[model samples]
Target: MSGKPKLYYFYGRGSMESIRWLLAAAGVEFEEEILETREQYEELLRDGALMFQQVPMVEIDGMKLSQTKAILQYIAAKYNLYGKDLKERALIDMYVGGTTDLMEIIMSYPFIQPEQKEGHLNTILLKAKNRYFPVYEKILRDHGEKYLVGNRFTWADVQLLEAILMVEEKCADILTNFPLLKVFQTRISDIPRIKAFLQPGSQRKPVPDEKYVQTVRTVLQMY
Candidate 1:
């Protein structure tokens, strides 16, 4: 709590990206320990820093946290971004849960086989248009609020903004049908903290390229 939270993950965005987004949205500046080699990760294992031997471990508030959901929930709660009540928190959880499912697909794209990359991209765009985007679009249409939950900028909004950008990276016009989401994306991106994070020289990671993929695979010892 005294010092800035320290994150342990690869140089590129993966499960750790959402954590970065949440912290940024909360206006919390943190440090990162990038794992560029297998030995660095194994050292964490050796020192018992990783709870489940995962890379997205965060050392914060005198605890070493792993598991993406747990870490996200803690940060959201601590930063007062979860919700004011249980019902609102439930909605945030639901919205974030759905968004996480969509992000997971994108996160795995780098490791996918070259032959299947086209099909994988098709799947991503398909789900974004048919399944995922519609859900948030409907929520915004019905809620008539600036954010998904409680009309306040919470973890759900941060996650959605991150997802929207990730999807748009694949297809620039993915939000053409979802006008509300396009507005939401622009509005959220303009928020002071998020706006700062969006600018150059922030902790935001770039889209995973071949070098990033190779580095991750090498560090994880994954063929």
Candidate 2:
């Protein structure tokens, strides 16, 4: 009800995760609004004031902005959550873009039959992870465990953790074989800020059940 910025998110959905994590990391307060049904979304859409072409839009002083990555960059810039230097911001963009690629792959599965998901895993997920994941591992390895950039927490780190956890929860075996990614993920999850965000009550909406998690995992791990 307050006039502060508001974020509209779906429970357990990808659109909201990174932004939610970033918001928590910045200690930037927000109003979390849930859209639990298509009807609700439709109603909002019908109103014609919602920003871009998706959920997880942020309303700042009643102005709406949409698209997950755009929202993220906006908030990061506004709150000084990105980093101090040009190189660090570039790295943040790289990792965040990588996450977007991963999400695209996962979203593609919705159109495939349950059985076909495995095929995607074998062809797409396998190739992508093998090629791209090591890049991320190397980043973490080079950063020396202080943070994604300059020994300071940035939106990039929050984005990485959320994307990694989404994979861990939905596709457990996807990156389990990567030592650095696994270790980095564990380390990120252990951060006090991130740990508190992962707590049950902090959730703005109910998480997907274990069965869905396993189902996603089973299909994604086919590679």
Candidate 3:
């Protein structure tokens, strides 16, 4: 609140990635306390910083917050990105909820076994094309609006753009059939704040590589 919000997570993108995107879109500069070892995670628990004993905890507005959705909602509201009215907020919530479903699958991708990677990738593409992408595409088509709700750029748009990039990382042609979403993605990415976040040397994290996966496993003792 007073100073920049500090994020607690691994160096890799996981649940914290959306928080990063939201903060960036809000034009908020934040700090990070990356966890590299199991001890660092335990210390947060020992210090009672993590209410649910989890990473992705954010120190913001004089409170230590955990739970991905709660933190995101707070940031969205604080930055006036939620929406103008309750109905618009509800629409944004529904759209964001759908995007989160797809993002959650991609979030777990790094931990997947080598042999299962292809199957998982297929699932991601399938869901993106058949289920997720179609919904947003239809929203834009029906509303003929630049954004998903109230024709205003809100948290839904931010989450949608993040989800689009996550899916594109799997297959570049993932949105070929979803023409409106293609335009939507371009429009959202071109926003000044969002564009800065997409540029090189920004806080945007790349797809998780072997080292990132191993580091996360080691920190969480997932082996």
Candidate 4:
């Protein structure tokens, strides 16, 4: 309905990166609208214009979609990123769900108090190291695939990379323990379209803000 598909979100990656990456990988032409402030966000939330009480809204092909996973899946389906078959789809779902778990922990950092933030972040990292990271590590190690689910690239790889980069950016040595997983990260990140989406002049921030950097520092135990 609109002149071109448009993605709406804050400046940071937040929950929008996967969708943005998907669009780029699929070579979809789209416009991006960045909501500049909390007040503006609150207004949108209060006005009931948002189907869900959140950002990362996407308008495309005469439909507006909310919820990150739903949007990712829709884009994946449209672009054939969900994997090649039912079995691959199941595997992708498993990784996507796990990545969502990891995201929940990282997303909590901004709301954490400054004094307690470091400890909270460290706890979340430990949670990842114990609960989340190894699952994917084993997948990459055992499956021996450059991508996550199938022989080809998929949305699962996109989701997994977004999650892994959450930790890798902060702790330079975190991925050292999981060599295959590290390679997987590089392989997906190197995808030409996703690579371009992450280039310096891209609309997204090149790095997380200081608050999130504090979380990364805590996860890496650098502070």
Candidate 5:
């Protein structure tokens, strides 16, 4: 809260969206530095804060932080959103890892060549439901809780919600076969601050690109 928290990322919703989500969830105030061109991003590399030469970097409390997940956990720990106990924190990490795996696929769609982008998007949609969503669905079923870990909201829920939103963007009806996930997604969407961040006119892309996504109304049909 001392120095203005600064975030660096390209415009639109990319890897940095989740970082924004965590900040909003924590009710923290931060400044944004949108990297608009390759030159700008390259220039940022000169600072050495971005060790990986990637974005979604942030600076807070006089420390330059890179790596999306690490920054997210840092904010979570700062806001007491990490979790209540040791085991819950571990489970939170597990779900966040799974969510990241699925998000990586959805995020790759735009960079793909036009001819291959459709197939890439379809694969992402399939993998999101087939390979990842079920784990959380089962966790929700077994735990009978509104949030992903423990009985309260945690950084894991924010991560999972972002993943689901990312996949839903690619496949609008992808969750039809997974009602539990749909509910889980809704629960997070209604969070007051998150709701405001997601309102109409927001910069978030509804999909990676309209041309690449296919309308998969039923998840079972992914096979």
Candidate 6:
């Protein structure tokens, strides 16, 4: 109980996961305000002066902040998690920028029609994956190491892992064909901090006992 700030997180378990994972990796302490119902969320919206209009808002000493990447930037800056050199920090920013595009695609999948699934949704992912894989491979190849950017873990590493996991979880078929992508995913997961974070309870909520994700898998299987 170090009296760290409180973070108000919503239930979707999307972009918020990256912020949570980065905090965990930094060993930061924060209270979680999980709003489970619309009534609760409405209450938050009305009764609070600085409350977030969206989920995944973090409050440091009662000051509210929103936007997942901005929260990561603030935490990374405060916790000294960015990097030592300017160029390295720039690289981390580059990776985070790339990850934002990946997140957009993931969020768009649910809106895609059945007929458009393979053509519209999967096609974008396939292209994005192909484009990003070599960049990651070059990083791993050039650094002669794991972890993106620097000697220590940064937000870039977390963002990269989250992007890779989203693809695997949502569209493993697209990933499996790319051996380098699979290897990159495996390599990132092997990081000790990341490996621990990927364990069962690390998810924002308890995943259903059954394979709820199977529905998405089945739909993808149809293509």
Query: Among these predicted structures, which one has the highest lDDT?
Result: 1
After superposition, candidate 1 runs with Cα above 4 Å error: none
Per-residue lDDT tens digits for candidate 5, residues 55-139, read: 6779987888888888888899889999888898898888888888777776766666789988898799878778898788899
| Candidate 6 residue-wise lDDT at 148 | 76
In terms of lDDT, the poorest run of 10 residues in model 1 is: 50-59
For residues 1-223, could you state the per-residue lDDT of candidate 1 as single tens digits? 5599999998889999999999999999899999988889889999999888777999999999999999999999999999999999999999999999999999999889999999999999999999999999999999799999898989999999999999999999999999999999999999999999999999999999998899888988878
How many steric clashes between backbone atoms does each model show? Answer: 0, 0, 1, 0, 0, 0
Worst 10 residues of 2 by lDDT: 214-223
Candidate lDDT scores, in order, read: 0.94, 0.69, 0.93, 0.75, 0.77, 0.67
Per-model RMSD to reference:
1.1, 5.8, 1.1, 5.6, 7.2, 6.0
Q: Which ranges in model 3 have alpha carbons more than 4 Å from their true place?
A: none
> Can you list the residue pairs that collide in candidate 1?
none
Model 6 Cα lDDT, one tens digit per residue, 1-223? 3467676655445556677778777777567775545566667678663344666677775467877777888888877889887998898899888877876676566556668767766666775667775577667767766567776778887787777776766566756555655676777678777787788766444322223233323422324
* Model 4 misplacement above 4 A: 1-3, 37-48, 206-223
Stretches of candidate 2 above 4 Å error? 37-39, 108-111, 123-128, 143-145, 170-177, 204-223
List model 2 lDDT by residue over 81-164, tens digit each: 778878889978987888777766655554566788678756555644676677777877876675677777777777777666
C-alpha lDDT of candidate 4 relative to the true structure: 0.75
TM-score, every prediction? 0.98, 0.78, 0.98, 0.84, 0.85, 0.77
The window of 10 residues in a row where model 6 has the poorest summed lDDT is 207-216
Clash-forming residue pairs, model 6: none
Q: Which runs in model 6 stand beyond 4 Å of their true positions?
A: 48-52, 111-115, 173-184, 205-223
